[model samples]
Target: MRSKFQQRRLFEQTLNKIIGCNLKALPTTCLIAADDFNDEASFKRLVADLLAYDCRYFMTYGLVAEVLHDKIDEVISDLELGSKGILTAAHSDEPIDEIAWFFVNATAPEEDCVQYFFGFDDKAAFNELSRAVKKEVQKLNAKFND
Candidate 1:
């Protein structure tokens, strides 16, 4: 078994690899999607593997409008970090079509945040949504930099 330090190093390497892949392919955001993997299990395995590292995972459901409008604080507060299963159970009555996964680097600055967007109908939709998300993020950054 690897020591905690070794495990963390490995996680960082994997995270960097994912980020690099996204940068080369998409060039806008580091948001991985289910379609990015060979199979659903592979995508899910990545999520599970990342859970062992020093990160906080959260999922947001149907909050694109809020994000676009810059009500991100409300969306963040509504997320139950590390409790996607619980949130799904609580909202079982609704049909969950998409889930946006946030892997926040607990030990690093917030700018190192990684995201995975899942459950879009196709690649076109995913690309469109990612572009919108990237635009909103840029807006937020500009607001803070001002």
Candidate 2:
């Protein structure tokens, strides 16, 4: 398993890549804190500084998951209703109070977009998230190459 420092470094690298490749998209990246941690404050600041965007703190991972999984229209409606960091439960009867996942959405003005959802509880989750980010980068690069 990678150390916390290693994980943070990898996450930063991924974010940098997204920023470099999608600068014109005016991408708004969000770091979702699913659970409390010792270094959450520092991490939150890091994400905000790197993306120059806001970090959303959700009370439960279930609510964040629901927001992530919901259709764009639903999400927009929620946002329109002034639900920025405040997420209302739309699913999950019993919300688990565990370190769930981190959510990142790299959206372009056009139809091309990428959304990453991966847990930080284990190394596998981090690796999966890394792969997903790389795939998105590749797709974006391909569009420019062509």
Candidate 3:
């Protein structure tokens, strides 16, 4: 098993790559910069609020690829679209430990959905955030699927 530090490092690097990848492909997105956030905690709170608002598709494309540590370009490429877009990403000095996000539905208007991004500094916080996100996503999936 990877140590917490290793995991955090990998998560930050991969997440930064994912952000850059998507940004290159879709430059005109409503990309909110890291400087906008006061700290990691505020960012987490914002993500949680956004997730509750409308972003429900916890995409595994970037995340799964990161965990496997392969096919990164291909995985990022798979995220490209004319309508849907990544909502937010990590900023300078703020290394993200994990990311849980909702994939935009192609059939719907972009403005109709809200996207969420989260980052963490502490390993324990990351784990807790992950669990919370999972539970929320489950609730969201049930609501949306119904």
For candidate 2, which ten residues in a row score worst on lDDT? 3-12
Candidate 3 stretches with Cα past 4 Å from truth are 1-112, 122-124, 142-146
| Regions of candidate 1 where Cα sits further than 4 Å from its true position | 1-40, 60-123, 142-146
User: What TM-scores do the predictions have?
Assistant: 0.33, 0.32, 0.25
- Per-model clash counts, in order, read 0, 0, 0
Candidate 2, residue 132: lDDT: 48
Native-structure RMSD, model 3: 15.9
Who wins the lDDT comparison? 2
> Which residue runs does candidate 2 get wrong by more than 4 Å?
1-26, 30-36, 51-106, 111-125, 142-146
RMSD in Å for all candidates: 13.6, 11.8, 15.9
Which residue pairs collide in model 3, if any?
none
Displacement of residue 17 (Cα, Å) in model 1 is 7.1
Residues 21-92 of candidate 2: C-alpha lDDT, one tens digit per residue: 322222233323222234434433433343333222222233344443243224335346345532322223
TM-score of 2: 0.32
